[model samples]
Target: MLEDFERGRVSAFFRRVADSIPVSDRPASLVITHLLAERPKFLEGVARLSDVAAVLPKPRSIDEGALRQVKAAMQVDELNRDRFADPEQATAYVESRAAGRSLGLLDVGGYFAPALEHLHTHFSGRILGVVEDTENGHQRYEELDKLHVPVFSVARSPLKDPEDYLVGQSVVFSTEALVRSRDDILNGRPACVIGYGKIGRSVAAMLHAKHVGVTVYDTDHVRRVQAMSQGFRTAATLSEALAGAGFVVCATGNFALREDDFARVANGAYIASVTSSDDELELSALNSMYARTPTEPHVVRYSRTGHYFYILADGNAVNFIHGASVGPFILLVQAEILAALALLASGQYGPGMWEVPAEVRQSIAATWLTYFHGVS
Candidate 1:
């Protein structure tokens, strides 16, 4: 059977947010793109609240069984990334599916924003604003020259802080799981974290707690200084960070590592990512340059110049390979997204990026504490 939704903390959190909004203010239709994973049980609850037009499964991290369950239960049009080889094709498909519908979007990694942007011009129906869920997506929206609809971002919101920290924990957990499978241990190893953002900070901290030596490198000088202040060794450049570390984790939701950087990785070191492969590493270039051999389940060895390195999960987020399960704490971010959707449907915000209101974040935190910690 699929995960028990009735007993899910995330499902209950979604219900609580939904109940707080007036039915008249709920969006009439929605297009959602998200990771089809068991831990994130909020999708079904969101579907029940609106006319879900189309559902797109995230490419790398989708859980097939969970996708099947969602498809069977919701009966919404399901779009697969494989069918639309090019991203533009997926955008076109969503446009066709969105015809004549006043639609709101709940997106992960900003996959559908371009489609929504296109729909804004000639769409017959209203374009309710979007609620975006990741820093990567938030940056994608920011890069757009102009926004025709308001965007509510929960990525940098305080409500997401707990989830981000837990995500870091999961990244480390999965990395260790993969390492231990090879009969190796992480303790006393020198590690490099390629970003000093929210998730990267937590990953470095957790690794340090386990007696690992952590070196951090970020393009931002301020973040580098922050890492130094936190008592972790800070690298002056990417090459410096990769040169000696026994393990590497890419936490920046950007192309943090490239083909040239791979040459700097220590031989026999394991590298993993915390976000989508495309956003974290240049896999296509690496594959072309190195000879790849399957080393283990979710592990691959790439060799050149008589030195080699291992990539966990074929460069995808290691946590997903180990079941990207972050537990009930993720519900806080989900609640914020649902609440933002309701606000967007009300048409209170205009065309631009809007932070989730402080009061709304506070209210969500209060409710979370009440429900999970027995604190009002």
Candidate 2:
């Protein structure tokens, strides 16, 4: 991109941040921003970081034992409890990503309202919503489950308010339950978990083991039972659980990181969206406010054979971001991106499995290089 800039192949970076236009297309100037982000795709096409990608071929999946060792090595407990506990960093991140439009989370699960709320307020007023995601998530909405589960999209009643029906959306990935449940058993600030489904349960158990305090508010009886059986106190009300949380972790399928929810939280609680969607993360308030505007353009690569994870916006999803994701998560995301990039670069970015450029693999590797910068 620098070369492109020097050769004038790309336009200068630009984007209208005013609230009037919510979803703006990526202008040519976006090329400059992507270059500045040095995202994998941008770096591959630019300075040719092919070796870095090659250096990181496909990674193998790991078992539970391997995961525990890595987590211990990373000192996740200390980080979660002391340094990175508050949503301030997460809010800052959202503010930068959202840039001025005020973030709006469509929370399918309202487990982490406190964290989400903090984001909206931190962004100077974004509107977020708590869209229930389970039959038990809301009293009035559980009946929607009877609607035919179309082979395609989830059933939607055009004539109904989600609060009036029970088809609560489900979120796929969330580490909140795990982290918060772990935090629940211990003594410190609480971490909120949004979704209480399968992954949510697993997260809760992980949290219990970690000895972290948790306060859950799910409509799912099974979830409540499971948590109670595990000795974790459950919250009967959303408002109660969100009273003074400092971190928000959402796993609900529908967007749980609503901007409006930010109102309930203090100025510091962190909001980490574990759901899968650029919609939740692509346009965050943090990004809009603090994201460097096409300043020193350079690719930011991150790869470490060991733990010390380089989370992408505090892991918007377990697959693309978390280090302890199921299987070789990073490799999976990298491989898919690589194959797609190869197709796109070759003008064959169609809907079939493809190969990733060696350079892209190498670019990911460079992200892991440890630099002391005179401190050492």
Q: Pick the candidate with the highest lDDT.
A: 1
Candidate 1 structure quality by residue, lDDT tens digits, 260-352: 888889999999999888889998997678999987798899998778999999888888876776766777888888788878877778999
Model 1 residue-pair collision total: 0
Which ranges in model 1 have alpha carbons more than 4 Å from their true place? Answer: 1-10, 23-40, 75-91
Q: What lDDT, from 0 to 1, does candidate 1 have?
A: 0.80
Q: What is the lDDT of residue 62 in candidate 2?
A: 26
Error of 1 at 76 (Å): 5.5
Model 2 RMSD, rounded to 1 decimal? 20.1
Off by over 4 Å in 2: 1-187, 277-315, 322-324, 328-376
Which candidate ranks first by TM-score, i.e. highest? 1
- Looking at candidate 2, the ten consecutive residues that score lowest on lDDT are 27-36
